[model samples]
Target: MTLNPLSTPLCVVQATISQHGERAQLVGLSMPSAPFGTLPWQLIGLANYIVGCQTSDTAPSPETFTAHMQARATSAIPSPATLYPYTPWHDGRVRLLLDVTLGPAKVLKWPQASLVIMEQESGSGSCDWVRLSRERTAERILTRTVWEIEAEAQLLAGRLREAPDPSTSSLLEVAQKAARWARESRKAARAALTISQAARARHALRMR
Candidate 1:
């Protein structure tokens, strides 16, 4: 979909939970530009690019993959393989959080992308990954999971509210909106988690 500046950008996340359910990891995609103008199909393209790069020893060039994904985006039918497992959560942008169970292959094959793992209980600490925030330097290409992102949004909104300058009004407005979105997103994330857990339970029972 074509998006304007006023339109909320869609942020897609590929999240993986461990077998023991003690920790969670996320797949972060590198964007060509700021997410403002991104299309829905392009998000799918990003996920496809990651799979293409990681699944094979020799990875396709980003350009080649972009072309391929763009072509695939034209299909009228959406593929379940490409569909995200979790319902999307909206913060400053619309977040499409996808889920998967982390398997034996823990290594990230893509050089440009990275996997960030976090404790399910603590929701703290990460190795080789950075939280998604505006203050992050341009060189870094990774983003944290939904919870962290939502927390950041709330913190930013609070800080904006504390600013004494009248000039911050517009910024504060945006921040407040983001905070509200974060809360709504959290609700969606919780619902998604419950559903995911139930589905996993069913699968385990069937395997017995």
Candidate 2:
């Protein structure tokens, strides 16, 4: 069955600033992608790992989404993650189920894809257990963050590209440069935070 785009799962992976000064809420989604379908709890497990717990149905950060949308040229999309359900038919395939909502209100409206995961029997095979592959989680988070960075970077670059289209004053040029710099700097700052946090972790580990 095709998923209603109005309510696809939004796996919110709460990124606590990585060891690389990077921060991103890696989202794992299990809508109808094209082939993967069926994994709901598994998706929850991963969500639990990243976004804490699957509490009240959370809505998209409109402000955040809006801002990102404004920078459209190279938007990396709000694609969180893909998950599917482990159906009997999906013996050797991985499956995931998600609760996704579209639009600002997420009023349940869109053509949600029910894609299937590659291969079968790929999951930890937990019924209700929240399977969190630390390695997979870390990998997904890192890759997701990089994707976001690239998207934002492209947006910033696009803005710069257009700055000269309307004849920006020297001051405007300076300001635009500063704006671009700030966006990149924020990303850098996040990396720094990650490094700082990691150093502390290592120190604590050594103390132990």
Candidate 3:
């Protein structure tokens, strides 16, 4: 089932979760160069959070995950997973509102899990529900996930330990902690991505 029911440049995807079998699945996603033209990395974080949970055996409680996500953006430790600089409240509103509705639901059938990625295209009065094939979705998620991890790693490496001017020592200390958190998040995200998927992600990295 589509979420928005309107046309859009950014593709929409749907994944169904079952009580058994694979947990969270990357249903489908499309990161178009239009609306996301300025912040494609945000897409990677979105993909990881969603797919990573789907693939995991033990999913985080919606509230816990939501808070875990919020702290990343609001705290001194800003995560690449956050939309801090780009959107107000760092997209927390979307997470708080839509995500809770995504979990297992009997209405979707006995299997009890389903989700849809919906986005509003700029200038388009109506929201869109894009369609992407399974292969396309997996490819996008894997590629984006790898790119985000590497980009963040590079950012942390460059700033994490930079010696601050004497006057800025206090700021540096805060940065250090934030960097550590970002590093940990990256490590966890990498680990959460299954071994085969990680391999594919790396290959995708190499190809680019």
Candidate 4:
């Protein structure tokens, strides 16, 4: 019997931000071996260690970090501060997004798997990751951003709208609405980026 993707156990993916001075690069970690139904605290600790190790050579030793993470895990109730809702993957796996930020670092690495990092850009599809599976070679992952996702959704909505089937009209309407919302969100995000850049420029002038 085939199981519903929604009913599958949760798999957490870390969408980390590696900050270098004033710039931020988005990083995604592909953990094919990530155990299903992993706890939030455990994932958080793992993410911290991964980010720490990648971001700096001076990062705390694995033993030290593990001890600290363990202490936090047992002492407090883990909150969804960095966690996002579940998104079902095409492969029938559900993914939970964990947002994390790492400070300035000169180098980044993941010994076990490849690390794909992309600098944020202005246009859609500029900072997104696309993972592809190949039968002959290792899995390949690329960067993707929210803007690209919205753009793709809008394009898909357009195609659905043009479909010849009459029964799809209702579905098309829903898709169009979602596409509109995504477009608005993209606009707001761009505006926010503009404001942030302006603020940084002003600060730079003040410092000078």
Candidate 5:
């Protein structure tokens, strides 16, 4: 189904989850994009970043894309062989919304399609684009997880070293020790990623 919001330049695509191959599933997605004049890359990028899900092929039609979104919702659960969705939360309000931009392209017919659209290609650079935002979520998650673990480890180690008697160490002591180890491990991981990203940037520059 299509939900035409009063929001200018953005068409909200709302679809009931369509399923195939013995898996009856339900999914909902909200993609924010220009209803027309949007680029495929923009759509792809926005969807990937905002939704954190994988899509096959470009979005050919509104209906088909909706199906894809539905499948994403289903795969989110522990059902079968689907990739993990990049959904940050299960809340409906936070769900990814699709905004279809009506570019210069036109579709002559309707209702004959089971999918919102058929296969089509952009005329080079004609995409609805948006600067990636809040994109560091993955890196942030990694960093935070590592940092917390590392901090815990350090705390434990500090406690242990100051322990009046190492022989009397008990569960709490053991936990603090583990936390200390985790903190260190996290620190190393954070550093590795930072170094890797920097190197990657350098490599990309050289390639460019």
Candidate 6:
């Protein structure tokens, strides 16, 4: 059965300065199966992520979606995590569930292509539990700042490829180069953040 599009899970990963030096929020979308459930989450998220490109007040801030699969990749123990989007239908807050046994897999297969919304057999009482089965939801939140950089790079490259004038072509090529450089810089920043987090973890362990 098809699930409700508006009911899809949305997890807020971070609230920080965006690539444009403006306040923004990064979110993750967990997808369980391919051919997403007709929800425009990624499209919406992409638009939010590129809001800096637009010069409109109504445009949303830089938000991103990190797609994840609910299935366990390795044959080892299964540990999983889940998030519930903020919906008005429920109480003021929603419950996020995490499974210690089964872990989630990052579904990098063509961006939300393998996401499936899980459903429970019983329709009464534990509706949230039902939604957990095979639900296409984001398990872990990654710094989505790279998405904007990568998108800008792609846009610049496309413009360069289709430039009608030599001057415009040169400018687009230069922009594309800069965008690529920025994308690389974002990658390096992410790597550095990972290292920083590891170091903090080690320090915390030693302190204990």
Candidate 6 versus truth, CA RMSD in Å, comes to: 16.4
Q: In lDDT terms, how accurate is model 2?
A: 0.32
Give lDDT tens digits, candidate 6, residues 16-49: 2233344444333233222221122222233222
Q: lDDT per residue, candidate 3, 4-90, as tens digits?
A: 312322332223333334454322222222322223234443444544454453443444344444444433333222222222112
Whole-model lDDT, candidate 1?
0.36
TM-score for all models, in order of appearance: 0.30, 0.23, 0.29, 0.32, 0.24, 0.28
User: Which stretch of 10 consecutive residues in model 1 shows the poorest summed lDDT?
Assistant: 134-143
Runs off by more than 4 Å, candidate 4: 1-163
**Candidate no. 5 TM-score:** 0.24
The residue ranges of model 6 lying beyond 4 angstroms of the native Cα positions read 1-153, 156-163
What do the candidate models score in CA lDDT, each in turn? 0.36, 0.32, 0.36, 0.36, 0.33, 0.32
Candidate 4 backbone collisions, by pair:
127-145, 128-143, 128-144, 128-145, 129-142, 129-143, 129-144, 130-142
Kindly list the per-residue Cα lDDT of model 1 for residues 99-189, writing each as its tens digit: 2222322233332333322111111345323233221110121122223434544654666668755544554454345445444533443
Q: What's the residue-level lDDT of 151 in candidate 1?
A: 52
In model 4, the Cα lDDT at residue 85 comes to 36
lDDT of 2 by residue, 81-153 (tens): 3232223232322232232222221112111111222222243457433332222222233233344344544
Model 4 accuracy (lDDT, Cα) = 0.36
Which of 1 and 2 is ahead in TM-score?
1
What's the ranking of the predictions by TM-score, best on top? 4, 1, 3, 6, 5, 2
Query: What is the lDDT for 149 in model 2?
Result: 41
Q: Please give, for residues 24-99, the per-residue lDDT of candidate 5 as tens digits.
A: 3333344333222133222332233212221121223434444454554332111111222333132222222332
Q: Write the residue-wise lDDT of candidate 4 on 116-183 in tens digits.
A: 22221122455644343211100111112223334544655676667755544554454355345444
